[model samples]
Target: MSAVTDRTEAGAGAAATAGAPVMTRRLRVILLLLLGAQFMLAADFSILNVALPDIGKGLGFSLGNLQWVTTAFSLAAAGFTLLFGRVADLFGRRRLFLIGMALLTAASLVGGVAESPGILLAGRVAQGLATAMVTPAALSLLTTSFPEGPLRDRALGLNGAMLSAGFITGAVLGGVLTDLLSWRWAFFINLPVGVTVLVLAMTVLKESRAERTAKLDVPGAVTVSAGLLALVYGITAAQSDGWGSVGTLLPLLLGIALLVAFYVIELRAAEPLASVRVLKRRTVRWGNLGGLITFTMGSGVTFLMTLYLQKVLGFSPLVTGLSFGLLGVAAFVGGALAPRLIGRFGGPKALVGGLLVQGAASFLLAGIGGGSKSWLILVLAGTAVSGFGHISAVVSYMVTGTSGLPDGEQGLATGLTTLTQLVGLTLGIPVLSSIVTARTTALQATHSAADSVLAGVRLALLVNGGVLLVGALAIALFFARGTARRSATA
Candidate 1:
């Protein structure tokens, strides 16, 4: 057998021992089905990025208002993930997954035809909801389908690769479509992809329903999702509305209060959407914290780079998309290799080592930032390597963090993981953007606005480097040693 085949067999064996259904030949089709769905989700992530300028001009939106295009999608997706995860467990994975795809497809079509920012935002939000529903079910299905061993590892690795590939592919495709044709093509592109994936999924994906008492804690889901939405919206708004403004403070305060209430409700509620017990696992807690930091830095870096390429480097949308291809390739390669790396070095060592390398790369790139210096090659290459390191770290954490939980608790774990990622991305963007904006504004009198922006970019990179280092330290000092192996096979 090929390495992938051998690994799949081992994963099947491990999963069988866990009392998961044996992976039959038919079951393997699930991976194929999932690939298309994952690609659609990942690609849409950066699709609108390059089209921001076009979108603003077309819709007569200010730069500030245009940000809602991205923000709405992100917060909606994050806010709904936990709710969807629980619903999937309660109802059925296959059913929910298909429903999500259908919604995403319809929403994409609507978005493509939107003439106003409000209509576009609405469609994007709907798409986000669909993403939330699809993503967790995809992960949960993989966990249940693949057995615990080499096969499972390979499967997860491939899953991660597809995700990374989709992200890069989206950037390039979105840029090309937007530049050559129109921004509308970016949204319209998902239509055919979604339709194809939906059809394939219906034909190939197996159905799995919760075997135990599949109760959903609606209160827990509502509170948690609403809290996250408030918090993220508040932060994003802070960039425009100012921290002291009621628009920012009210949402921020309410978000904190609602989140606190969520914790309290989870503690007392029977049939909680996310069991409080999962957080008790030292591995789960620390892993999630680490995930949060990494994701935050990762998203911030991407946002900064996207801006820099277009505004500073004078790269057209197509070139900017092409430039980001390096990071995407690195991520794909890293994800594809993660299973072997985990089997060899173990997940703990990989986690710490990856974070450290990523931090170093960020610092290196930041150090090389000067508009006169032809450092794009060096910086891009370093960022790519950093992406590689991050991929391994993420996949290892994901597998280990959810390890050993009862099948019933799997949805909770998925929900928590998604929650952390959402919170991280939500908070990270505005904080970094605000920092850069503040720094640039402060320097506008002293230097050209363009130069000030570059300076701000460099500062943002420095800060991200520091954040990555601190996150690495947290993994090494507080979490890595214990969870490395335990969580993998838990």
Candidate 2:
């Protein structure tokens, strides 16, 4: 019996060796396919922002109602990300990815055909659910497929670049579509791309199952998703209704209570979706906190800048989207350059310094009042500075946060990182929007809509700059100085 067991184990080892090369080739194929899919998903989020006015006009939506077109996708994506990540671990990454792509494609079709705002929002909600599945699965695939070294770093850098590129491309593409075709085509455009990605994914991606099987934490998933959704919705609604409104207050309070309950549930669950023990690590803890704050500021800035350029500066949608190209370029370059910077400066220094620089850049822009200045050149300079700093800080956090984790835990780590950004951006929009809305109202009492919008934009940037300053302080206090040099080989 002992001899037979030994022989079986030997045969298994031999088979693994024989299959290794083929597996490597398959992983490369899978990486490219997932990258393409991720780019499409990321692009879709920002692409429609510039097209929002056209869409509202075409659909006959009120300005306040139109925000849901963006809000629905965000809330859904943010709420279900962790839940879907856990589900992927339980089922299979390849399986969930395929399912997500299909759903996204289907939702795009529905969105294109929708005749009313309600239907469009429904489609967006579906798209959001699909994104929740796709984003984390894509990251998990990358983490598992690439061996942990320079290869992985390059892959991640490219991934970050693609994410930025997608946002830029989406803006340009959405503008062209809205101008030439109808706003409906902004969504319809996803159909062909999604199909192409799905086909490639099926051919190239190999299935991966969890090494240590665990049951789904149903209560945890339910409570957390619900809490996040509630919080996001309440915040967004607060822009229209007063923050103290009972409608908003009830959900906000419930959300906090549920999130606290989720923590307690996690402690008792046999297999917690996200093990608190993992988060206890210094790198993971601080990285998540800093990421949340930075991303919140990023979204707030982007939204305000868009409003300023289009409504105040009177730029065309196409031109407005095109203007962002410079910032996008900076983000791409910054991500590509981050690993080198981290190797030289260490993690903590890069993070804190980057945040400080970004905050300073926003303050610089704020100093330039909303007057009739050389609007293009001034905006470009400010955006480029902030964009470079933002990407630098983000890439640093990504590298440091997931660096020391075991392979199996990489999914949760990535999920946590993404969750922070997702939640931050979703919540931050309303926070910044409220500031803009309130300030716009006050400014309008004394000025025209154009001037009022510009004033609100300036105010939002100032507030966001202050928030980033706080983040910089947090980074310096928590992250060690040598993090920049830690990944020198990468």
Candidate 3:
């Protein structure tokens, strides 16, 4: 913000007050550290999928409860993110970021060394909450550090690229590590990375705190966290427990009840943690909805294909992971090109283009049939195209969602985006899984096992494609339409 006169006056540091926009080597270093934190968190999300089998054996996790090894992390992360994001706004971003890193590092150490399932589960829970803190704090820091312009767009694009790269690497790296080294390395791997991020973040990142402080509403935090936890947990469990089962219905109902209570509490609380007023912004609402839709469609298709590759085609874990390698490359290219796309056509148009591309990719893949020699090409091209669309859509949303927020609310804005992303992922897995189950069950009496599974995969792909197309149309009609009407007015 060195060239931004208003920000220069508002900020105190030499870095902010410089006149020549301070596009220095040092600022680039800061950007890398912030993005590294993003990669760290993203890697953890996929790193354990291949390692879960080994983790189960090593820790004696029963098959019934073994899935929680992964679920626990997501559950805790989604639960506390809103509260911690607002807490960072109220307290200090940098302070909370460093603390989160420290906690995550410690949790990693505990999980890495754990000899018992209980201990590992506990570590995962802490790691999840720590991730909650770091994600929003780090993102808000990046948003606030760079002025909202080409520079910030470039930074956000780069951040999105690293995030995509991390997911690919994590999926592949986990299989490699588990085959060659040990599953424990999956948890231990974050040790050095987390520490380095924490240390570098202290140096390159400047402290930014809200100008005004509000009292933390403890009751609201508790209700909201518990509510979100139950909601996410219920959705996740729906795949295994059956949506109509008592186990699933109970938590889901409780989650809804608590969430409603949280709304009431927030309305009545003195100095509410987060005001519903932020939703008044058109960009926030549309950007978040767009995010939720794209992520759900992307992850849903990927999950279905993974099951198809492993179950029907009998592909090894390593091969399945390597198959996604092209996606990372395509995502990097898209991320590099996104800023230019936004500059030319604007964020809303870029968003519309992205969703269309993703929808087309999903549709193309939906046509792949069993025993076709063309399956390989279909998987590669579909994933590559989706990669381009996914990164572009994500980067555009990041820019559009946080575009106009004041510095004081950056944390909250980022928090909502992160929250939507997790919720989308949490719900996507089960939603797609349930669809596949129902379709596969229906075909079992009429078809072979492999054919049933293949048919189910195709059906899931169609559903994913249909959803993405609907989302694209929504973006075109609502958000992108505003862009066109504004251009006409101008």
Question: In terms of lDDT, which candidate is strongest?
Answer: 3
lDDT ranking, best first: 3, 2, 1
Rank the models by TM-score, top first: 3, 1, 2
Which lDDT tens digits does candidate 2 get at residues 341-394? 776776556777778878988897785555563677878888888888877777
> For model 2, what is the error of residue 213's alpha carbon versus the real structure, in angstroms, after optimal superposition?
0.9
Measured against the true structure, the TM-scores of the candidates, in listed sequence, are 0.91, 0.89, 0.93
State the weakest 10-residue window (summed lDDT) of model 3.
5-14
What would the TM-score be for candidate 2 when compared with the true structure? Answer: 0.89
What lDDT would each prediction earn against the true structure? 0.79, 0.80, 0.86
Off by over 4 Å in 2: 1-28, 371-373, 481-490
> Model 1: how far is 416 from its true place, Å?
2.1
Candidate 2 at residue 186, lDDT? 86
Model 3 TM-score, all chains together: 0.93
Candidate 1 backbone clash number: 8
lDDT computed for candidate 3: 0.86
